[model samples]
Target: MKNHRKGHLINKGNAPYVLLAPTILIFVLFMIYPIIRSLYLSFFELKSGCYQFVGLHNYIVLFHDRTFYKSLFNTVVYLVIQVPVMILLALAIAVLIEEKFLRGKAFFRTSVFLPSITALVAYALVFKVLLNGDHGLINYVIELFGAKGVNWFYGEWSARIAIIMAITWRWTGYNMIILLAGIQSIPDSLQEAARIDGATARQRFVYITVPMVKQIILFCTITSTIGTLQLFDEPFILTSGGPNNATITMGEYLYDNGFRYLKFGYASAIGYVMTIIIFLLSALQFKATAKGDTD
Candidate 1:
C-alpha cells in the first residue's frame, strides 16, 4: 500500500498538465502556427506559383498601392460612421427597454435582436434585394412618399452610405443587448437614491448610469471598432466591393490579393498591417478611457 501511494504521488505532479495538453496543443496548432506562418510569408512573394524571399518589398508595394489606400479609407469610414451611430442607438434602445414598467419588453427585445442572429450572408442578400435600384421594396415605398428612388450601389458616396446603413441595421441590436446587460448590472438603490434627491431623468442618466457602465461601454466600443475595421462579409456579399471599387474594404482587398490575384505575400503583409492598426487603435482607446477614468 505504501508503494502504491508513492506511485500515485509521482503521477499527480504531471496529471494536471496531461489533462491540459489537448487544449494547449490545439491553440498552438490553430492560433500560434497561423500567426507565425503569416508573418513569415509576409516577407516573401510568389512568382510562377513559387515563393521567393522579397524582404520588405511586399510591404513597400502595399504602402504605394492605390487600392490599399482606398480600402483603408473605407475601413476608417465604417469605423467612424457606423460605430458611433450604432453605439448611441443601442444605448437609447437599452435605456428604453430597461424601464421596469415597460410592457411586453421580452417580445420587443427579441424582435430587435433577431436580425443579429440572422446569418450575415442571408441578411446581406435580403438587403441587396430590398435596396435594388429600380423596383426594390424600399424604393417602392419611397416612391409612395413622392421621392425618387436612387441607385444605392451606383456611386462612391452613395454606396458607402448604403454600406453604413446596412452595418447599422445588422449590429445595433447586438450592441443594444450588450448595453442592456450592462444596465441591468447596475444597482437599483443608487438609482432610487438619485430619484429621491430630485434628480432629473437626463441628469441621473448622465451622472449615475453612464459613469457606472463606462467599462462595458468601453468594451463594446473596442469590439465594434475591431469589427468595423475587419468588415468583409457585407461588402463581399452585398456589393462584391462594388461597381467601381467604391465599397472595397481591407478584408476584401486582402482576399483579392491572396486568392483572386494569387498574391499571397502581399495579402499576408496587408493582414499584418491591419493587425497592427487594430492593436494601436484598441490601445489608444484604452489609454483615453483610462485617462477619463482617472479624472
Candidate 2:
C-alpha cells in the first residue's frame, strides 16, 4: 500500500509544470487564441452568418475609407496635443508635491489623484453636462463674466477640446502620482550635494532630478501613448463622436464597425493596422529617448 501511494504521487521535477498548467491554458485560450483568431478573421468577410474569405480586401478598403482617415487624423490630433500637456502638467504637480516646504502634502496628493479613480462613464457624462452650450455650468460662468457662452460641442474644434480636457482631467493626476514616486526614489544626498556645490533649485531639478527620473518618464510616456491611441469611452459618451464625426477616434471607429455596423472583418483589419501603428510609434519613442540619452 505504501509503495502504491508513493508511485501515485507526482514527481517534484514535474510539479512546477503541473502548477502552471491552468494558468498556461487560460492564457492560451483567452489571449493567444483570440489574437491569432482575430488576425485570421481579418482576412474574411461575414455574410449570412458565414465567413467568406477575402484576403487583403479589408486592408485595401480600409486605406480608401474616408471615415478611417478621419478617425486616424482625429486620434493623431489627440495624441499630439493631450499627451504632452498632461505629462507636463503631471511633472509640474509632482515636483511641487515633493517640495519640502509644501503644506498638507497628503491632502494635496489625494486631491490630485481623486479624478483618476472616478468611473469613465460618469466623468464623461459630467463633462458633457458642464460643457453644454445652453445650461452648462461652464457656459453659465462664461455668461457671468459678460462673454457670450460658446456652444462647445457644435463646432469641430470645440468638441475636440472638450474631449481633450476631460482626458487630461482624468489622467493627469494618475501620471502625477507615478512621477511623484519616481521623484521620491531619488536620493536626497544627490540633491544636497548639488545644493552644496552652489546649484540653484532650478538647476538641481533640471540636472539631477530630471536625469534620475528619465526612465520613469519614458515609462509614463509609453503607457500614455498606448492609452491615448486606444482612447474610446470619453468621446463615445461625451459627444458620441458628434458634429460631423469631428471627435471620432480610431478605437471608436473600430467599435462602430464591429458592434454597431457588424463589419467584423473590416474592424479586425482596423485593429491590426492600429496595432502596427502603435508598435511603430512606440519603437520610435524608444529610439528617440535612447538617442537622447547617448547624446
Candidate 3:
C-alpha cells in the first residue's frame, strides 16, 4: 500500500503545483500582498490607531505640500546632472581599461571596482568627514593653496554637489564594469577593419564602438535613472537632507513621512506617486531607446 501511494504521488497531475506551492505562496505574501496593501492604504488616513477612508485626501495634501515639491525638484536635479556625468565617466574608464597596451590592467580594473562594493553607510560617512566645513581634508587642501575653506554642508548648491560627488564615486565603477563587459564582447575584427579603413581612433569609437554597445548603454541609463529616482542613503546620512532641504530626495521625504511622522497612509500615497513616476519614466526611456534603434 505504501509503495503504491508513493508511486501515485509522484505521478499525480498536480505534482508540479505541489512542488511550486511554497514559492508561489512566498511571492504572494511578500510581493503581491504588499503592493495591494499599499494601494489600499494610499486611499486611507491613519487616525487614532485606525485607518479611515479619505479618498484622495493624502494625494491632494501631498500636491499642496511645498516640501514634497522641493524634494521632487531636488531629485530631478540629481537625476539630470549626475546620470550623464557618471555614464560618460564609466564609458571612458571602460574604454581605457580595454586598451591592450595599457599596463596594470588588472590593478586598474580592481581599483576602479572596489568603491562599488564598499558599504553604503560607510562611504557616506567618509564623504561627510572629507567635506566637513570646519576642518575637512578638502578644505585643508584648499587652504594650502591660499584659499579659504568653503563650508560644503552650509551652502545649498555645495551640499547638493557633495551628495552628487558621493553618489558618482560609489556607482561609477559599477557601471564601468558593466560597460567593460559589453566592450569586451565586441569582435576584434571590427576594430581592425575600422583601422584598415583609415578611421581615426575617435571616429572608430563614435561610429563603431558606441553603436555596438548601444543596448548596453541603454540598459545602464535606465538603471541609473531608476537608482537616481530612488536615492536616499547618501542624502540621508551625509547631508541629512539639510542646507535648507536642497539635497532632499523623494526617497528621503518618503522615509520622513512614513517612519519619522508615523503617517503611514500619507507615506503610502507618496510611494504610489513615486511608483507612477518611475513607471512613466521607464516607459519613456523604452520608447526613446526603441526610437533610437530605428533611427
Q: Residue-wise lDDT of candidate 1 within 164-245, one digit each (tens)?
A: 8888998999999999999999899999999999998898889988998899889999999999989999999878998778
User: What tens-digit string does per-residue lDDT give for candidate 3 at 43-150?
Assistant: 998899988999999999999999999999999999999999999999999999998899999999999999999999999999999999888999999999999998
Off by more than 4 A, model 2: 1-11
Cα RMSD of predicted structure 2: 1.6
Off by over 4 Å in 3: 1-15
TM-score for model 1?
0.95
Worst lDDT run of 10 residues, candidate 1, spans 154-163
lDDT (C-alpha) at residue 130 in model 2: 98
TM-score of each: 0.95, 0.95, 0.95
Query: Tens-digit lDDT track for model 2 on 148-181?
Result: 9989999999999999999999999999999999
Indicate the worst ten consecutive residues by lDDT in candidate 3.
6-15
Q: What is the C-alpha lDDT of each candidate?
A: 0.92, 0.94, 0.94
